[model samples]
Target: MLSKSISSLAKRVSSGLTPLRSNPEFWLAGTIPWLKTEQLGEKFIYSTTEKISKIALKKTSIKICRPNTLTIAMYGEGKTRGNVSIIKSEMATNQACCNIELDPELADFEYVYYFLKTQYNELRSLSSGVRKNLNSEDIKNFVIRLPQELKDQRKVAAVLSALDAKIDCNNRINAELEAMAKALYDYWFVQFEFPDANGKPYKSSGGKMVYNDMLGREIPQGWVVGALSDWIAKDKTGDWGKDMAEGNYTLSVDCIRGTDINGLNGKGAVAAPTRFILEKNKGKILAPFDLVIEISGGSPTQSTGRLALMTSESIKRFSRPVICSNFCKAISLKNSPYAFNFAYLWKSAYENKVLFGWEGKTSGIKNLLFEAFTTKYVVCMPSQHLAQGFFDFVCPIEDMKQKRLKENDELALLRDWLLPLLMNGQVTVA
Candidate 1:
């Protein structure tokens, strides 16, 4: 659905691609995380940690694309293909991506970035066939419309960039808050350094440790060993069959898929496709503190048990109800005190490959062995007071994370809404 104004503007503008030339700094695949999922749709990305060497760049047929360069993934699966990004630093990319070095005199880079974000689906459609890949030529000839007034373009970019910056700020805040909570979790539960009677670190201050046969180690005397099932009030994999074609279902809701759980404990503004389901099945609707785990679709390198925590504030981002996709299992905790703790536990298990033992293969895909997973996994059941203490200490931080997440959702919505309107000139900067 291309806007008439955008279509007209695209016709007027010329597009170009950086010429491929032999370079020594060629990444040669696997050298760096040359490709990314989070970087897509972002205004700027710097691969400081996953960067290619100058020698590799020199040996390969790669060009050092300049900053503010808008690029798109020329090939990949799902949303990976045709996704756009702006280079924050001079970087080299594989041929699978198309780099567009826009002329500043002709267009504002930020305005073009936002335009591409809105037209992503259409851009994606240019590629055809089973693999759905676009080539450099496809991007070279791709069109963009620029405002006659550079200030107008800047104004539009400014409005959208402000929203993006705010969202980025919130994400930074959430990352810091999550790190704080995780550090506390590791200190108290893993290191056994919980607060003691005098508000001192418990295990470090020698607060009553005892041997526990179940864990094969000494734990705080009062804690009991229990399975994850002990804390779960309800557990079930999600539904998928009820499509819009199904006469039973009416409105559609964004279905959270396995790929959507991007973070260790939760997702950050994952884009999910909508699916229709029966209103009665609203019971499957995700609630705050509900744990959504990926039960299927894992690769050898990636594990199956990816986890995400639904926040009370975050859940409201959807208009109707949000439900997990079939590949995920939603677990509602019996109590709120265990929410943050269990999220951390599951994350640790996934990261450490502890849960891989509870995985089975089906149709060439890795699946979480549900029954075995529930029965085999063990948890240290700390006293209710201790659990409550941890929750009380972290609750404010959690609340802050959710509020920021919710704000990001709103900001994204507003930015998206304004994009086409601004591009079509229905909304003006003045």
Candidate 2:
């Protein structure tokens, strides 16, 4: 085994640059995929949110990296600072990322990526400055121990990669299931192409239509125009209980925060904490089909209205009954049958950027005008029978998606448990 500084094992170590955003030519019709700290949660990245143009590349210090270059964030307030991801295509990054291009002969790229995952806290501690951020020098100077033989290093990486491979497979499956749900919602609601009495697409089969001044579109004759709030039966704000049990704080439950929405939805790992609250708040226990909506805490690039549907299956993932944090609120549809439908409708509105219009700034933090947003956003309401039908169709799909998610959590736990032991030579792959 040999221990060496990361700088010695690499061909180059550097950070990237962000082109001046005010310059229109730097961004218009861009083609090169650009990366940011926001895209670091994944293990392997094939694409990014924004791309850079040729002009920006030529005019600035920004440079695109080749495939397989390891990238890590230089800073974060929470768990992001030391997070790492490997790009699978040509890409450029912002100044906040530290990109490492390792010499293939000396260091196994995947091995180093996995090693760094276990060193998040240690790596973050290396940050220095008023911003408390990491620079390229800190990363290059970091030391790692690996098997002297290249083949041995590959063996360890292969074991860990295989585990992540399974998780990736699950992610692909979950994504497809999510798309299917959205397609069903769009067909039934947006296109009005839901199945008719004769089992044909409703709108296409010439279902009766009426023009409503509010919806500004022709909906089915029986379909009514209703405000979003009309469909909701209850709007209960969440409770943020004490972090530890205290006098009179005896009830124990898992508290989901605004950040845990993605993890609960299976996009990433959710680490919602267990909290102690008064027994009175037990009435707000999250039930199946109830939607947990993020009401606060959004970045400038993101919004505060992310949504997650609680399920009987998802609830089982927690140690106890779950409640959302103060940053979020739960909404129950007028009826359990319409729960899934309304959830889908809210998602459509969010994706259409409607939430952005309804958001307001208070103390520089963006907040959703929950009542105003819900009251003004109009939707062509589905009848109870149709809503029930959609609910029934989605139940099994949610079941399958959650099944894979639970498996992923277990798989990830195993991988994380093995990672450090494998890297430190406490455990061997072969």
Candidate 3:
């Protein structure tokens, strides 16, 4: 039954094509073996930093697809959480390029890309290989259902595309807002610039001033030196004694190694495909709005002690949970109004210190000790009004970010719902 269907589809495709048997380009000019799956980024196309020689490209028969073509990675490693992305660029040396040219009549490229991404897991399950690979034959043999009308395809693509376009716009807005806030921070804090009483620009009176050993420059008058521990609570006693029961509580890592920090959620929210969990460990269950810091294990001097704000939901889901391996989670004090900004500030300073301290070191992962973080430092405690004012100024940007994320999530759901339906003809474009 499958063979007959495939043969019929092949004949139909052949009939639609303008035959050119003699053209050399009609056949693939070259074949290449993918360098490795790990080399591919979340965006399609592996980085040139990991490129192999032209000789290596000839080892495999895979041909590159054009930019914006609908493609899929037939084999998936456990990495990427089963993601599928459209081809965004020309062929790379180490990737199994798509062989099938996209059918403009059958589907919109972006629509097809989203559909395939949604069905990524199903495709992976059908793929055969120790490393998980799907061949071109497998893809061609797979059936796709479509509405006979081009208008229907356009309609379906348009609906989904609008959401994606909105999401992209929100992302841009968020980026701009963040850039604005960072610029403000640099101007006031780093550059020591503030308005004088007469609204004239002055260095010392308008901004908080402080002396810094690191900078060898005197800062604004009101600024003071401090550590994260001063504003946040650090459970340094190392006592998780009673909370270690296996079933009663779960421990989670403060950070997931090899994952992007931007993707991590706090405030007791659980992101899908939770990769890290804690065994029984003695620690307080994290609370909502609590700041969680990755105290250990990132680039040794860089990204160590990175921080995130835990929502209330995350605390409920993973409270009493063991701290996952290779991470430490710290919660900020409830009273600290500036905890979020403080987290960012401390992270920046700590990361800078690490970079300076670990120059030329092979180990990127840094181990954070509780004593150093808790006992040694103080944090600037600006008045609640000031903190609130700062947050108010930036809240719109944060809202834009949240909106973008929500739109992306919705787009993902729609894409997933459409993939198998369109592929199987259950959902037609018309």
Question: Which regions in candidate 2 have their CA more than 4 angstroms from the true location?
Answer: 58-61, 75-78, 360-364
Best by lDDT: 2
1-430 in candidate 1: lDDT tens per residue? Answer: 1322332333222222223335433433435334343356556777734456555555455466677777787777667887888878766666666667766766777888888887788888899767877766666666776577778889988998999899888888889998998898889899988878888998888789898777789989888898888888887569774556478787578788888888323355577777888767878888878899999998777889898888866666566678899999999988878888888888888999987788888779888997687777887878777788888978789878877776777788898899899877788887
lDDT of 1: 0.75
Work out the TM-score per prediction: 0.82, 0.95, 0.62
Error of 3 at 51 (Å): 9.9
For residues 1-430, could you state the per-residue lDDT of candidate 3 as single tens digits?
A: 0112222333121101111335444334433222234343343443333323344334434344456544445444454323445545555423343323465654555555555555565666666766666665666656544445657656766766776566566556766776797776566445645345555545644544567684466755555566656665554222222223355434433332223334443111224222233343434445445565555555422455556555433333332332323355556574655755675576666656742342232355455665565545544544555566566665555555555555555665676576566655566554
Q: Sort by TM-score, best first: what order?
A: 2, 1, 3
Per-residue accuracy of model 2 over 70-131 as CA lDDT, tens digit each? 99999666678888999899999999899999999998999988888888888989989998
Go through the candidates in order and give the clash count of each. 16, 0, 37
Point to the candidate with the largest TM-score.
2
- Judge candidate 1 at residue 346 and give its lDDT: 85
